[model samples]
Target: MTATAPRPETSGPPALPPLAAQVERLVALGVLDAAGLDAARVHDAVQAVDAPGLLVVDRGLVPASVLTPLLRLGDRAGFVVEDMTDVDAFAPTDGLDVPPSPVYVVTAPDRGDDLGNWSPEEALPELAARGRSPLLLTEGLHWALQVPEVVERNFCYMTIGSRLRKADGAYDARTPAVWISLGTGRDGRERRGAPKVGWCWWRNRHTWLGFASGVDRLAVPLDG
Candidate 1:
């Protein structure tokens, strides 16, 4: 009998952007309100969380814990982490304005591939825990069929991606989730041949797909 060849191992470590570098890029985009940053905390977060894996969306309150680790990085970039809760509940929200730049990693909290993997049911509760009521949002192309719960929230979301298509020219349902930023994107879209939105250069890409109930726009008020 002929011996069978073994299959290659699939999946590897996530290639998330470097924390310090990503913070700098955000400053260049002019989204973060990098001022009066608690420098002490930024230093601490950088010292504590060294790996990119620690920042990717996962089952934990990393946002609350790790959000301030880059105060110096952000302060230098001219963007400060506001006292707002909702926008940064799921991910770090840069800038200090209503609807401040929300950095959504299309990478699911459980998986690392694309945004489609996450459903409203799975992500909403966490947002609520953080006191957010923004409409569940994602890439507009697959909105209607994928996340119908968007009607329950106030505003839609817009994010960037590179892993939605497959060899068969259909949506790659099995594809992993990716991390997105309603606020600022990563440093290498062209390098990876990713399909960015029309003339997008930063991570603060707030293109809402829907809204409702006296909510005229996507707003992230700083009540804290």
Candidate 2:
């Protein structure tokens, strides 16, 4: 994730923005909210079209069909578009292995009070030692529905495929946990200088869980 500074300022035209820019454009257009969920559309599209977004592929429909419509909307609205729905779309960064497939984990911090299936004692310290303040739940926030006493020591594991991450990378199963600091997570306030190891995702009924990545792969996309 560590790349040296710029080679030189380009006198030529600027580069195209990354896919995130288009996503922002979508937000401004009411296609999605600041949280990135196309609520009304997700409901409408799912019912009427039977896909969250779609393209009439041949005579059938595709799953997670939001990509095409977004691309078309980006073009129609005059913005650069890129497909970033998956890790395969991003230009790889060194040591940026995928985090483990997220599970519906409802856990609380291990404050010497015996509770929860997972009890991570070293992950937060390691990340802190590396000067990384991973995202966390705001104190007094009941987002995870964790019982009052055992709330907020949230950590997520990494994955290689649909299975779990079994590689001997720096963040393997042995040392596979990452931290979650306090903040307005869905508001995108967590983005900044440090590399984005992973992200937090949840629904009204789901626990506020996150993915932890070791590599930093952030390239600002254009608004075009």
**Runs off by more than 4 Å, candidate 1:** 1-14, 32-35, 38-45, 53-119, 122-224
Poorest stretch of ten by lDDT in candidate 1: 208-217
lDDT of 1: 0.26
Q: Whose TM-score is greatest here?
A: 1
The alpha-carbon lDDT assigned to residue 66 of candidate 1 equals: 31
Worst 10 residues of 2 by lDDT: 53-62
- For model 2, the superposed segments whose C-alpha errors exceed 4 Å read 1-118, 137-224
lDDT tens per residue, model 1, 1-224: 11223323334223435544444443443324333333333333444342331111121312222322222211221121232223222321232122232332222212211222233223333344443332221222112112222211112232222123335865332211112223444423322321112211222222221111111122111222
Could you tell me the TM-score of candidate 2?
0.19
lDDT of each prediction vs. the true structure?
0.26, 0.23
TM-score of each: 0.24, 0.19
